[model samples]
Target: MNDKLTRFLFEDRAVRGEVVQLQGSYQSVLESYHYPKPIAQLLGELMAAASLLTATLKFKGEVSLQIQSEGAVKYAVINGTHDQRLRGVARWDEGLQELPTEFSSLFKKGVLAITLAPKDKERYQGVVALDKDSLAACLENYFLQSEQLLTKVYLATSLDSAPKAAGMLLQIVPPTSETYQGGDNKDFEHLAMFADTTKSNELLELNPEVLIHRLFNEEDIRLFETQDVLFECDCSKARSAQALQNVAKTELLTMIDEDGDIKMDCQFCHQQYVFDAVDIENIHNDNFDAFNSDGRIDERTLKH
Candidate 1:
């Protein structure tokens, strides 16, 4: 099945919606690590949420959803761009015997943060406490607190065999003209009822068209063109080397002396990058001149 996100608007009500189904992209993320069952499922939901949230971006940069806590699962994060490319990672305590299944139990005193980093403008961040039972609820709370918009989010994941994730979102749109009155609680509630009835199996299996038809066959839904979603990591040797440049030279030299080289592993894609003495020296002396005017590393300079 194609992993895609579909957006739609209700002609009769001042509300918009988004639905995303994941198959290949979700599986690609799981293949990178042997995450525990609960953690895998949580990551899947976060990825789905990230995709849905990124679809709302009006700028040309990336957005990230992160959950941090001092619980068994230390942290989980997913990043996505306006184009729908996504990547995620999760970290947890080692040798934990029991993992809580509920969000409150698993993430005691946790915080959920959404960050928007526009390419040309200032970045914006909004944070909320993880006081809800599910990730979807926490996201809804985020909208309520930050945007003050009546929004609803539904997320589901299945890791039985082939991992997959799906999610749907609905938010009331502000009226633009006198003819277009703002959405009321009654209209939002009526739509939310249908959304709340979505089953995990239906979400993971059905296509967006079929899913929307099944749920809102009575409503006037205007479906838009689907957008593809994929598991994409932006990590590269150049980026990794530039990151090394931020380190103290003495610390890097000590690492090189002890290990003969410094190795860096991308937490998102698990790709390993090795920097030998020559690579380190070249990077140190170039003063980042290896980077071209376009901000991309000149690969030819690293060959020496």
Candidate 2:
């Protein structure tokens, strides 16, 4: 299978970039929920955007890209670690849109939040309202405001026969060493403008080398090897059990009384975990992980 995401350095300049193409991974996230088409596309874009954002930061822990609103789109978020493990989910109101709609339609009005957490250090968060037309533009505004750098991003998604979502980032890094060779800010600007001319199809279909040459043929360029972006969710039954422990005992009993069994499902991967009265009581009594029904996870519950 073709690798889903790849990070590359220009080598000539301080700018570094990444390209993410998602098909199976994107589709798996979409399959987790029956969201509207607009929401699906938004989730795809957000996932790709999150991957690109994580690449920018040489982080050792977690980074989450979240867009929350009280309007049509309640929440759309993607989480990734430094290892490039990614998962995303989106929630929206009724009414299915046949195709990808505008960002305003998906998130009527809301703020974007980016939280970066390092394992042994304090977590950092940045928030900004959706004053721009697209999520891509919103993120670009975020980069300019938070990092105080001139950054540009090109995001494209094709809803055609072969759905592919791709994105690119261009950022200028100030030289830090005594033997520093300064970058021409004006040249970076021109290069970004040229990158802005890229099309969605070209991003999705064309080979990376071809695409780079098409965008920056005039400039000396180098491309790195690709990394796979696989369809994987980190949700598990153990985590669900931990959640059960967190819920109040009264609420757990009420859920069992009302619904026969409490069925909790993970939004990221849509995996369901069902619990009965005995299970709830055990959760309340013991802080242990979990045990199967029939009071046995060993030979007693064994099948004939």
Candidate 3:
């Protein structure tokens, strides 16, 4: 199944919205990683929320919505590109509960940090205390405090759908010069309060058109063309080699001597990059780029 992300604009007022649904796309991320129920659910929610956030960005780059904590579940992160390509993973302690219903049960005390990075521009980050009852609530507050604009986010996921993570967001766009408030922003305030009543079922199960219509029937809404979202990870052995260059030759050579190989992993996709003695020598030697263990480097790949 193809993944879908849609954005909507309100014709009558200064507000916008987005709705996303993942079916096969969500399940695909789960195939290689075996996560506990709570982590899986956390990943699903993060994936859905990230997709919505990525679409709402007014710039050209991507957004990383990371959830880190000091409790048993130390970290849970989801990174999503502006093109809708998403990939993420989590780390946690064992003997945890198999089933988790409340969002707080996953992490006793965590912080949701959001960093906005554009390809050719400066990066900006905002931190939100996980003091709220739910992740969505915390993000809503983040929008209010950071942007000073009203925003609401709703996300949901299920394994029964086998790999789909879907979610929706509704927010008021800051007023344009022409629409600047004079006395009171009664209309914008009403819209934001209305969005607070959005149900999880509507966010998870409804079609984009039907969902928005149900929520904003009194206002005129404009829908944008839908875009495709993908589960793509930008990782390669060459990129791995670049990172290795920063390590000391003596240390890497010693690791190879002990384990007979140098192995590395990509935290985002959990991809393993293994390098043996010959591989380690190449990195330290002058001809690091010229030598390759037989059949190790795929010859046809393009460099990043």
Candidate 4:
């Protein structure tokens, strides 16, 4: 099935939920690299989680889920935008033969960082230790510690032939009244119980509507319009050029002199951007004016 993210609200209870199923997008991410089974599955789950979290953004921006560790899996991150475009990449230690399935074993001392970068505002970030066995639990802990909201996350992935990922999120809406005594606990608990029972296979195989209906048939659910999610890397030659501008001009020139050209590869999409001597000269002369004020390269100046 095509990738999609769906949001639903409980009319009778003060709660909100989101469900996302990823297939084509998940496969697109894995196609760029030959990841191990455990790492691939972890990346898929991170992608699904990033999509679900990105849907919750109230502004035009992107949300990134990053895990940094000192274990075999050094770094893994997934980026998702408000529009649902997603991309991810991971790096691991060389000469590592076996990767453990547990989070603690994979990341002996790691931190899970969630960053929210808005298009027109300051960015916000939160970090939590990866003490839990599962990414879902670690994210839940993040919500509890950072937002102080009762949140539950369920993530699943299938790394077989056709890779896929699915995730569900439920958060309790805070009480508006000052005198309201936390009566929504029971309601949130009731819904979370059902969501927890979701099976990995079911989540990967079933559609959003069917899955929701099967899980929360008794609740009055207001399903919103589905949003399409796809794997799209935002990297471009212009961005790469701008990055080159950040380096010392002498360094870039030296690289061009030694290698005949400077080649930069995007880790997420594996797209290579090559900068020849002429391109480097243009970048230095124009002082990056080859790019417009909007940060996009001018069509006339682009060579590749």
Candidate 5:
């Protein structure tokens, strides 16, 4: 399936929905590392969830969905931007030859954190416990606690050699005094009932139009234009250089003395950036061009 996110609205019910399917982007994430089946599956769900939630952003920024746990999986996160770019990674126990199959066992004592960072506005974050068996259920609870908007989420992922993930989100639009007359809780529940009947394979394989029809054939639905979603990592040599600036000049030089160079690897995409003694010197001099001559990453230029 093509990587796309589609938004739709229930004309009379005051409800909004989004459906997202990922194939190429999903493969890009899985190829970055040799993730176990369970980890890959979990990352796939997180990727889909990130795509669905990022669509709600009205400003220019990114959304980060992270899970911190003390179970077999230590940490997992997916980052998505307002324009639908996504990247994700997961960290698991390195010693385990075979990962556990039980969902609860995999993420013991886990907490899910959803953060929205806008470029020109203050950031907001919501935290919730991962007490549910599925990621979808956890997200549903997050919306309930944070926004108090009746919401439902369904996430599904394929475990085959070529991984794919898809998700659907339904939310009740906040009611205003004039618009709240007939758009009651029952209307939202009626549509949610149809959404709950979606099968995993159907969500993973079916196209958006067909899937929407299957679920809400009788409802007055207005499907919006599709938005493209892809796996694009923001890591680059320039950003790596900027990150190094956070370290003291003396410390950076000491690292070069010990190892002959500094290496930075992005966990999300596994791309490596190497900086030698000269590169470190240039970094300390505030010379960004030496490392980012190609202009691969958009780094801020500092005035001397």
Candidate 6:
């Protein structure tokens, strides 16, 4: 599959790696909004990173990578589930003459938040500064601080008519033996050195197997089954109706009176859900106590 992820382990070393390629799913996210070139590129890289990070999860839930800032690009987030399903969205300041190329310029005081949301357990979130030049570098810094493990992340994206993104992650597994002190492993550094040689074009265009072989021809590696990655959004009319519950009943009635119906658009997928007065009445009458459990904002106010 063009959109798939593969996991591999170094048999003789305490290192694990994952490779992810995205094309169809990447295109789907771009199609939902007319994003600027830089924003589109950022989203692609985030998607790849999210996929790689999601594979590291041992639970049945999703991982979200979010960047919040006060600069031109105000907010951006990509959510990826354990099964590789993904979706993303971004918001930026309007009327900007040009978008900045540097990460710091685009996001003043920006912080990257990595959140692990489990299906049945409490969610965990870690934050790191966006001081690095690229997302890959920021992620590496995160691994060093939060995980205390050496990690190498390579992310590449092509914003062509058919957008594509791919990434590789190599990490030193936790020490299991007394000899393996809490630090970088020699074998991991060796493999990471080889992985760093991969060019952006090679990552986006080469097959996963061929790329792996080219990077570590001498290492004994065990490749696992490939998992498909898809662009999926869970926003629905019912969910939109449920979201209306967040608004005050008087406000809902006022909106319906002013427009004859209240319209809600999903920020992620741009899907529009319209609710008439009758729909609003039923929504209030129904017992949807768990409406906000999903934590999805179905109604977004347009900014001038």
lDDT of 5 by residue, 1-304 (tens): 6899999999999889999999999999999889898999999999999999999887899999999999889999899999999998888998988998766678878999999999868999999999988889999888877877778999999977668999999988876623423234998889988998999999998999899999999999999999999999888888778777777888878887888778777777877788787887888888988766443333222211
Candidate 5, lDDT over the whole model? 0.87
Winner of 1 and 3 under lDDT: 1
lDDT of candidate 1 over 215-295, digit per residue (tens):
999999999999999999877777777767767777788888887888777778777778877777767775554533234
**Model 4, poorest ten-residue lDDT window?**
295-304
Residue-pair clashes per candidate, as listed?
0, 0, 4, 0, 0, 0
* TM-score, predicted candidate 5 vs. hidden true structure: 0.91
In the range 94-132, model 4's lDDT, one tens digit per residue, is 678788887678896899999999997899999999988
**Per-residue lDDT for 260 in model 5?**
77
TM per candidate comes to: 0.91, 0.83, 0.84, 0.92, 0.91, 0.92
lDDT of each: 0.84, 0.72, 0.74, 0.85, 0.87, 0.86
Better of 3 and 4 by TM-score: 4
> Pairs clashing in candidate 6?
none
In terms of lDDT, model 1 sits at 0.84
Per-residue CA lDDT of candidate 2, range 90-121, in tens?
77765544433677755556989999988778
- Summing lDDT over every window of 10 consecutive residues in candidate 6, give the lowest-scoring window: 295-304
The CA lDDT at 21 in model 3 is 88
Candidate 5 residue 58 Cα shift, in angstroms, is 1.6
Worst 10 residues of 1 by lDDT: 295-304
Model 4 CA deviation exceeding 4 Å by range: 175-184, 287-293, 296-304
The parts of candidate 3 lying over 4 Å away from their true place are: 97-100, 161-163, 176-184, 192-197, 281-304
User: In candidate 5, where is summed lDDT lowest over 10 consecutive residues?
Assistant: 295-304
Where does candidate 2 stray beyond 4 Å? 1-3, 95-100, 176-184, 250-260, 277-282, 285-304
Lowest-sum lDDT 10-residue window in model 2: 295-304
